[model samples]
Target: MKRIFEELAFVNVFAPQSVEKTTDKTTAFVDTSGAGEVAFLVSTAALGAGKKVTVTVMGSDQSTGASAKAIGDAVEFSDSVGTDPQTIVVSYQVDPANPRYIGLKFQHDGDAAVLCGVAVAGRSLYLPAANGWTVAK
Candidate 1:
């Protein structure tokens, strides 16, 4: 029998925290070697008054991020930003082909301070979905 937990894995891309205006925040590269389809969740707390969160994806061959490079275009969940007034959870899907490691680089620009976080959940195609789990049948 296939278990749901056995087919999915989650990683903290960026923990929830208050981001300062015009400051660039970056996350360490995460290994996605065996993942097939991955979803990145960007959560925010009350982004208002033209406050914006811009996120860009970077791909690397190593987790150290020394070989990091832009994988694709930047994706913003709700950057029109004043449009949303409450905590929102936005998600994006990615299928990395060449790189084994991926990281996020984002910036928040606005007049108000906002709490934002990011995470990734992925399904593996070349290896076990979960990092480490023991289940008996």
Candidate 2:
């Protein structure tokens, strides 16, 4: 016999899983003394083939003091990073036009698995985030 609430209980009608960004107290401000790259891990629940994930780096202009950064382009998610434990490391392309911002994109285009683990790093030119992810110089 079919249960009354069994169907509803198994149903997962929600948005795609995502990583939660917390405030970095130690390296929250961008300075010359200690300013570098930032790493972020995307949740496995939302990691899949053909899935689109955008990573944005936030920073401020020293001269103008205005907000600035770069955004990653959409790419296919693949398992080329690893086999059983697939993970790819894509560096953010920074240029003179987009100064102080390092944007990276990793796509899983091979196997369809939950990508839960992520390891990201910041470059020397990269700046720290005010209320987002950042790394120490």
Candidate 3:
């Protein structure tokens, strides 16, 4: 078995006043042109009262266009009033031919913005005939 690691796509902290009130903050696009499996690592500094966060994988056939579609259901992590810091990690598999571009979406909901950090990575194994592997450089 071959193993590969992707580069860190994004690393930043998001706060209520910094981000949009009702919108999704997507990370830098990753070229998963030949990747068979992708993974996302999401972490948060701290969560305020009535705050929640959801992470999902988004894909597209074209680098930049309207053909992009969400890969699957979002993985949600919520915090109640006066909760501690939280973190979530998830992975997803994709159709190598369909999802050429891969990215992560960070969705936040609450009266106050909760500081959060998100990063994405991907890996792929060589096909039987190709005998080669690719990863984020």
Candidate 4:
């Protein structure tokens, strides 16, 4: 038998730094074909006073993001307190019926360009899993 380790099946990195404050970024589509769960992480430098940024997780059927669309409403993060730097993450459970590719989009509304990193991680479902689970002595 093998330890499942909740294997990290795949990862995609975007905009390690140098995110333009006025431009929007749509990341390259990442294949999520076999992952059972996916996590999206966005780490950003100080967001500048009164500035705002929006993070969106989207899905597409094509690697070029030809059919891209947000999975849900874009989430907004603001530096209401001024110069707030933070890391935010969103997780999604893979649905076999949905498109097999996903990506991230960042929209910045501020005057200062911030250093940011976006990472998408795909994790496999636990091995030896069945339709139901049970505990034994």
Reference-based TM-score of each model: 0.71, 0.32, 0.65, 0.75
lDDT tens digits, residues 63-96, model 3? Answer: 5524567778887777775467667776767675
Q: Name model 2 segments beyond 4 Å from true.
A: 1-72, 80-83, 103-115, 122-137
lDDT tens readout by residue for model 1, 1-137: 77877778988878889988667777767787666666666776666655667777788887888868877787654446475644434333446565777777887676766787877778876655474556756
Which one is best on TM-score? 4
The residue-by-residue lDDT of candidate 4 on 7-52, one tens digit each, is 4654556757778776888877787766688888788887777788
Report model 2's TM-score to 2 decimal places.
0.32
Models, CA RMSD each: 6.5, 16.8, 6.7, 4.7
- Model 1: weakest 10-residue lDDT segment is 85-94
Among these predictions, the greatest lDDT belongs to: 4
Candidate 1's TM-score: 0.71
- Tell how far residue 41 is off in model 2, in angstroms: 7.6
Poorly placed runs, candidate 1 (over 4 Å): 1-6, 79-97, 126-137
- For model 4, where is the 10-residue window of minimal lDDT? 1-10
**Candidate 3 segments whose C-alpha is farther than 4 A from its true place:** 1-17, 65-67, 80-82, 129-137
Clashes of each: 0, 12, 1, 0
